[model samples]
Target: MPEEVKAHITGVVFQVLAKPGDTVGAGDAILVLESMKMEIPVEAPRAGTVSAIKAKEGETVQEGDTVALLE
Candidate 1:
């Protein structure tokens, strides 16, 4: 099954941390978001392998937007 990793806040992607084929644990940050001069992490909801990254660096993402896929 595939799981969607979502952004918790509206922000521009500051950096991408996990790439496709990378393994991550629950709460692992897949990317960083910059909003209001602060950097926030978009984390994996559960332990899984990264299948895809939908957001790129400097991309603007809204809250609840899918940032990555986990399988």
Candidate 2:
């Protein structure tokens, strides 16, 4: 099954740390968000290979928006 990494808060994407085909562990940071002058990391929900990134740097994302897909 595939797992999704979602944004926890509304923010602008600060950085993307994982790319498609990258192997990631549970809790690994897939991307970072900039909100309220703080950097927040969006972590992978499970161990899997990164299948896609839905958010890009400088893009605004809402809470609960899917940021990446893992499989």
Candidate 3:
């Protein structure tokens, strides 16, 4: 099954740490969001291969937006 990694808050995507086809463990940081002068990391919900990155660096994302896909 595929899992979606979502943003927890509205913010600008600061960095993308994983690319498609990358293997990731549970809780591994996939990206970071900059909001209110703080950096928030978006982590994998489970161990899997990173299938896609929906958000890009410097892009603005809303709360609950899917940032990446894992499978």
Provide the lowest-lDDT 10-residue window in model 3.
1-10
The TM-score ranking, best first, is 3, 1, 2
Q: Write the per-residue lDDT of candidate 1 for residues 1-71, one digit (tens) a residue.
A: 79988888999999999999999999999999999889998888899999999999988999999999999
Ranked by lDDT from best down, the candidates are: 3, 1, 2
Candidate 2 regions with alpha-carbon error over 4 angstroms: none
lDDT of 2 by residue, 1-71 (tens): 67878999999999999999999999999999999899999998889999999998999999999999999
- lDDT tens digits by residue: candidate 3, 1-71: 68889999999999999999999999999999999899999999889999999998999999999999999
Model 1 is weakest, by summed lDDT over 10 consecutive residues, at 36-45
Compute each candidate's TM-score over C-alphas: 0.96, 0.95, 0.96
Model 3 score (lDDT): 0.95
- For all candidates in order, the CA lDDT equals 0.95, 0.94, 0.95
Model 1 TM-score (2 dp): 0.96
